[model samples]
Target: MKEKEILINWMEEGMTSIPNVLLKNYRRLQLNETEMMVLLHIYSFSQKGISFPSFEDLSGLMTISSSDCAACVKKMIQKQVITIEQGEQTGYEFYSLTPLWNKIAALFESDARGESLQQAMTEEKDLYSLFEEEFGRPLSAIECETLALWIDQDQHDPAVIKAALREAVLSMKLNFRYIDRILFEWKKQGIKTVEQAREQGRKFRKPANTEQVSRSENAVPFYNWLEQ
Candidate 1:
């Protein structure tokens, strides 16, 4: 085909326009340029009815090697940026971009919420910073997402979340899973505030304290009654 004809034919076929939001915030999703390009190519292929592309096919469209492409795909799967679902008719597993779309949709929703979104972003960022400061290192993307879900999906107040973190810190377990368990237990008990959390802690200790006092009282009762 002539260069002009090739250009015309390609244009006639159509174009791929990535979501601007995705392009703008790719780094926040921990996607490197190569990974982003690979994802974009996969999206293009999916749109063109090629849902599952081999590493060689992916590497053909870019400068990356098949090894690198496979690595990127594995990393994305680990981070939950991509998932594999069984294809209906073929029974083959295909990479699904639903998780990626969900993250992008969350970003757009946050953007649409205006000031509340800004405040939420600030609060969530601050919470991550606080956890990192306590843990003495940066949080992984998964850890950050876990914290965000606590606030957004679980409807846990930031103060209550902080309280749980504090409890974890004091207990010498400054990890996301430990904090998550604390929050889970608090939710089960309907503890929705920092004060309620403190009250619940006291309630748990109260029983032990009362038991200790009862044991002491019982030990002295026989001798004390005889003396009286």
Candidate 2:
């Protein structure tokens, strides 16, 4: 009798898809534009089963010079965003983005398991400390309730809500109403993660949103937006 072997081949499978977390969080990883583009191109090629791409092959598809691509590739390798290995097909060097994806996945998992606003404030995260760090004072009771509401009723991810708070602080618009407005807009757009919220923020500079932001700055009754 002959022994049978089971094999699983990714190339035999269909289209290559990237995770949303990776796409949106690349900026958080501190990847520059060139490194991001280089990693993306390599990913595209790998999806098409092209294990190895020459510097010329990679640079030809973009307006960047081969030297620039080479530099970016080197940076990506150093940053562990990509890894090079000898492929079995031809024993030539190939690049892989598994390292990058692993880092992205770990981040998402951590966020998923991380504490909620209330738990963190009372427990390990010491969110009160964080709030003090940002606001230069301990959070008031109503402010604490607002944070809890953002976590509980709104079901907004805690990290995203925290990020919104940081954004409001940076914009000099720190207030419960302002933070609520930010959460509302994000919820309207179906943004559930910090990465999605961050990505949207990058594209959120428009006149209408600016007007809305101005309105959000006006003193409204606490939690009034929830009723509206």
Model 2 weakest lDDT span, ten residues long: 219-228
Residue pairs clashing in model 1 are none
lDDT of 1 by residue, 130-155 (tens): 88898888888998889889998999
> Cα deviation of 175 in candidate 1 (Å)?
48
Evaluate residue 226 in candidate 1 and report its C-alpha lDDT on the 0 to 100 scale. 13
What's each prediction's TM-score? 0.48, 0.45
Candidate 2, RMSD to the unseen true structure? 19.2
lDDT of each: 0.81, 0.73
Against the true structure, whose lDDT is highest?
A: 1
| Alpha carbon deviation, residue 6, candidate 2 (Å) | 40
